[model samples]
Target: MRYTVVLSYAFTPAWLSLSRDERNAMEEQYIQPVFAKYADQVAARFFDAEAFHAQHTDFALLETEDLQAYYHLVEELRDTPLISRQYLTFTDIRIGVEGGYRTFEVLTRARE
Candidate 1:
């Protein structure tokens, strides 16, 4: 089964206070590596929503078949400066499976 997780998060003042170079460095040193480590197990796409939204500044749309790897990815991210040092604040997360109704339908047929 494949799962799609939408993680909505905001960029804190601390993050904006950093210079472009510093921000790039932070992503390179902390954020990018974690995603790279989970590259095979998860597919991630980040969206910039600051201009369009009021509550959250950005969101990551992640798709994965392996929940364990996804969980580990989150754990690693929590340890990074992005979250630990308050660079990014998570606002909400929505998890679901595409075509989820089909799974139930299949189960219903099997039981019939």
Candidate 2:
């Protein structure tokens, strides 16, 4: 089954205070590689909630058939400075909203 993962996160003040060069290097040397590794199996998208008057700072969508890749990505990301330094605080993980009729079917059946 295909999976849709929505990861919502907020950035720490320290993260926002980083130099542009520092931020760029982190994205290039760390973050992007994580996505690149799973690029073929998953399509990743980023949304900046800060511009939209939202609670969270950022959002990411990951769609993949290979679930293990998702797990690995999370594990790897957890150790990055973005996470370890508490820069990117993960808020939630939402799964399977885009599961077509199966989504409705499952929710309907569970309502019994």
Clashes of 2: 0
Badly placed stretches (over 4 Å) of model 1 are: none
Candidate 2: the clashing residue pairs are none
* Per-residue lDDT over 1-112 for candidate 1, one digit per residue giving the tens place of the 0 to 100 score: 7899999999999999999999999999999999999999999999999999999999999999999999999999999988999999899999999788998899999999
Candidate 2 C-alpha lDDT tens digits along 1-62: 78899989888789889998998999898899988988998889998888874568889999
User: How does candidate 1 fare on TM-score?
Assistant: 0.95
Looking at model 2, residue 72 earns an lDDT score of 92
- How many clashes in each structure? 0, 0
Q: How many clashes in candidate 1?
A: 0
